[model samples]
Target: MLTCAFLLIVQQAGNASANTRNGRFIVTITNNDQPAHASLPGPDTLAPPREATFAEGRLAAAQTGAHSYVSPADSAVRQQIEELGSANTRKRVAEQDPPQSIVDTCRNDPRADGGKGHVFHRLWWCQEHGFTARATDTNGNLLGEASVNYVAIAWGSYTSRDILVELQKTTLGKPTGVFSDPDAVRFIIGANCADTGTGNGCAVHYPTVNKTLTEWGNDQEWHNWLITSDESKSTSPDLVLRHRWNLSASVEVPGGTGGPFPSPTPYHLIRCDSATYFAGRPKACINDEVLPYITYEINSAPAISVHDVAVHIREAQDTPDLTFPPSPTPKRIPGKYIYENPKDNGLRRIPEADEGPNRAVVRQACDQLRPIPSDEQCDEYPFASTMEGAASPDWDFSAKAVNGRENTRAGGYLRWYVFWDRMLYRDMDSYYVNIID
Candidate 1:
């Protein structure tokens, strides 16, 4: 049985439109709330899209009636009528009937509770980009109204679906094949790392390079295989990774007497750090190493090329407040050889020597190094480890060393520290072989 759930009456702001010339009224009836005169069967026994009726009256009369029910005050009734004027004179009208589609979609066809007296009656009016629904009482009194815009809903759904699909693919362990093509790697890095005036916001990055990097890095299947042989590590750790590796593969080696570019094809590195764990196990240890290969041509002087590598070692420090020694180091790793300029804080320093293979060229370059004036705070570049908490501290480094050089030239020396984490083995080999060949 079609039941009235609610009733709604809307006042037309202007003359009624042609379609609503008879005036518009919305009345909701449910089998559970059947009026005394209603002879409809229970919701479960009646098929839906059935028509139902409701009793409606002037707003003032309804109010007066409700008050009279509470208290039979003759004087109060007269005062209300005098203030509200003649109820019969009010031009109360019903909303046009709801379209058949709304009736079919929202009407309770059969009692969801199997005739337990609970049934829903909903009426909707389709609009341009969306639709609106209203619930009304038996008297055609407005109960509530809800409006939904389909365009916004669809957009939200598409965005959510895209993210979910990408996330699933990432979790499934897809191969990036970045190592196979140096040019492709370079292009990706350039596209992502270029200064596009967007201030390196994550939202801006999500649709471009960051999305790809995240998908590639989150390949759980690939990580599982990458760490399968390690007895201590059962799965790839959840790394705080980013794309900050820079290479000199595109530029002429500073020294080397013009032999060849150190790297053959231009490629970038994916920098990552141990910051989180899974199943109560530490994901990755902070034992990775960074190396910088620099070539300098001083005033037409013979070009000098130097390669240096460094590993971060946690040192124990004594403190007065703690029973055990506290590591004096702040949660954020500081640049190793690099120091924030106390003066302008605009400049940085790199070693001038050209001979050592494991020399200190830039200190803690991949650490949480910030730009000068401190207020301009170093662009954490892509992600900020502090936001995730000290317990999960990590930084992913990319192999775009040329970007580091560019950063240095731009006076973002602290930001340039990411170059320290370059993947010398894989990327450097490509750097040398591609150029030499």
Candidate 2:
């Protein structure tokens, strides 16, 4: 059961693709309420090598649908939105169906990126979708959040099983050795526009309108153990006490020079914070648009540190049969549905899931049997804290100048996205190592 989770490249578009053992897989989304779908655009639209049937799961998205852009009643944009789903929608004719190698519980099987917990979904989706996405809402208004598959594993496995076996025999088996590889990180990048805010008229389903960024780059929220693993010391039991800011990170603005003033150099998408949404592409931004730029950076450090020290706690409590003993064997068991913490505002959680008022007392969680902590919002383009902090009463993403000036100052902390490659990813590409999430 792969819960729907994601952070996107700067803003939302239709599809985002990521690299994998089999090349790449694309993520398709409909944040605008206008339900949209996609297919590979080569010779014959590549059909999902393995088509897994979705069971009777309740829809987490709103049912509202609309088709317009910038302005709700814009007829021309509305027409363009209408053609999103049905446009170039391709389906393959012939491909052999392969046998699955493993059988995982509903809560775990069919999972391609779950080893990373919830936040990974965001990073994975951002990478996959952004790789080669063409964002155009089915409804121009960008206000139609009907229903959609948050992500689809479109690479080699074809089916979840094919992907899982390789994972089990390799990564899962030797988590210590395999997960350390930097190339292990697999991902892609996409492009599109962003709106202002609620006042700008972005609906609940496709609240994606309003202020938008370019790419949603992320990685596995900081796992204390993963952090220490890279360090020579603290090698026992894979230390799990480190604090990790799930999506907290630094960004590398593609084609960026030194500041955010000149606009993303390439201006991936015209962003205007004045007229509620974008102010609709100003001539200044259009000409100054560069590739990617550091638009937002998480202000928090992604590492967890203990504020106090503790002595031995009665040799720790007895544990369950959590390990596989000393035998070379595989384990299997039944499980339940995974849910989001009632307190979580992310769609990654369910409608009927648990909820509470206080952030601390309200444990954001899922119903899954495994006590997996989900960093659901990490890796969303720009950044979640950045989003929650975007239009705060104190700060404003719309501020033309951080200090009331026209152009941003030099050495300014221009926000940007950090496209993450997971610990298990098989690619060892170079990186800027901007932030430490």
Candidate 3:
């Protein structure tokens, strides 16, 4: 029975690999809101001109018992009123006119009632930075909303160079082979925030949006991870890293503010590393150790009212049970696998001395099987060894006020680290790391 089951698993794995043509996959992220469909205004849709007779009739009603009803000055005032009303009508129509499109398909999406409503725009072939979008109402009010959907297609046999080129073209907008259908390629949604909210699900402040992306690209730790070809090479066989942004204006708080707050520009980056693997085995050997690291900078001090700022590393808690051991079990093999490294094992922390202005640089390496010590000290190292069985150790990072303050209101840079071991063959196919506040 065991042999039969193993063969079935191998067959399924082969089928999955055959389905992948060139090893290319598409990734899409959206705001979870539906795309805004509104109508464009044209020259013929202006409000009709108001009649002079109707205006004069209303004025006569107000002067029925007044003594100045038939004065010469009243006739002159009526004439001026009619002229001003006509001019005002024309001015409003002019203000409502739509701007010329920079590209052929870039135009306002017409509304159902044949009135100006919303704008639906597309951004393809980005020059620098990733694809982004923004929308506004007829009055030029930012909707602070976005939704995206996209898929990946394989054009040829998968190669690291080819995969990287496509990723840069789709994300940072590097020019590549001309795509026939720009509209079908990709989309972006961007908007400005008018104010901050005290509740969850509010608009994301504009400053936070700029700060997060800027720091992500500038931080040295992030740069090393992104540029280091060998570190993540096993997990990213095609050398393609997938990222999706979930831009939100909401946050969790005590007592639940009726709505979302815009202050923290809450966002998440979903990263996926794609490396090919066979049924229950990796195509090539990899280092048994996995190291995921994050680096951040506090650009300025927190508000005076703020008390303590902290960084937290959380890992999944589960016991490891072995069903099938290695081909040949060791004579002294233990009953169960040790899921976590010792508290003092392979831990490193380097925190810069505090300056008078509340600025410091701190780095911590926390693995899935181990937690940062209660006193937050890293002073030990242990011999590294590969695990005897497959395990998944997922971890995340969050920086905020531990006490006195409710949430972080100030701006700072933060990144998270996640590591995987070679014993788990799946890491060669894909790996994930997350950042949060």
Candidate 4:
């Protein structure tokens, strides 16, 4: 899933039709509430594509007959409506649904540069409302009533450590009967990031304000909020741990009729450390990002051409027909290096004198070419630092007789590439070696 998601981002990064260089937040409100009456049309009456339904029997008691203004049945229904509304609001606020694809949301976002290589973030949340009101005639006669349901959603899009929050509402139902109260119901949607004792601090640029649900059948426009934090100053910040942070979005009804819904039960909407952000945007964190990789140019590092040649030949065409010199295989050589102590099995960082188990294998492959010069050494493909080294039992590797000094220089370059690329341990990460002439 992480690999596919990252690949999607890479693909989107190349699309030319993207309109904005900054991310955007889209919020929507949906109403599925309906009047409580057997004679009234049901959800099937709604236009095509809407699958929502009202709480069938939730307001049945009120529909039987209207009672005194302070009747127990009326009060119970109101309380039930409030409870359901709060619970639904909590569930929606805790959930997340990205408005668009990753790169489209990030690169096109206003916060991110209209170019590649910058980090962007996005989050989505929804809040539900179960509303009820007493139905009465102009002469104060009792009449059947219904409990109405509504949903509000908030989407937060950000880039380079800044958060942009936006809220929207959609009406799924139209209330027809006259209700006692006609005032608009207001809601508040916002976000927060708690300190985990880490020096990294977070702040909201402005306070989130309450927007009205506006009458019975009306729609709500998007509201906005912003949060900002420090970005790493390093040129290559993928491996640097500048600030560790987690952000949670929220939705609430001010008068306690709805909710103070926080993040989901155990998850934050989004969490990003500099490493995962710059390396590649993960679903939400470092653990979920695609594996790291390194690219080596054979032309630039000519001293290691022998090592490249070995790999090229190893992955070369198995049989040659009309071709004079067989062409190297088009497929890339994929392998991973291991540096962890226990997992290396004495193969990593093989010594110059003994060559360890790696030397024994390489000697068997290159013994025929030896005795040429003392300055030369037997070189092996998939270096001793890799799990697919000459000593590895699971994989077949190649060995070639090459200049010893040049081989040593190649080894130094490999070390620098590993450190600079932040390659992780075997299994945790895998990389492809793209041999470019």
Q: Report per-prediction Cα RMSD to one decimal.
A: 35.0, 27.9, 32.5, 22.3
lDDT of each: 0.20, 0.17, 0.20, 0.33
Candidate 2 regions off by >4 Å? 1-241, 245-437
**Candidate 4 residue 391 C-alpha distance from true site, Å:** 2.0
Q: Which TM-score value belongs to model 2?
A: 0.16
Q: Can you write out model 4's per-residue Cα lDDT over 142-198, one digit (the tens) per residue?
A: 332223333323332222444444344333223223211224333333444333234
As a whole number from 0 to 100, the lDDT of residue 241 in candidate 1 is 26
- Model 1 ranges off by over 4 Å: 1-26, 29-362, 365-400, 404-437
Per-residue C-alpha lDDT of model 2 across residues 238-347, encoded as one tens digit per residue: 11111111111111222212111101101011111111111221111010011111111222222221101000000110111232121133321111111221112211
Query: Per-residue lDDT of 307-370 in model 1, one digit per residue for the tens?
Result: 1101011110111122111235433332221111111111112222321311221223323243
Candidate number that wins on TM-score, 1 or 3: 3
Please tell me which model should have the higher TM-score, number 1 or number 2. Answer: 2
Residue 198 displacement in candidate 1 (angstroms)? 38
- Per candidate, the number of residue pairs that clash is 54, 78, 22, 14
Q: Candidates 3 and 4: which is better by lDDT?
A: 4
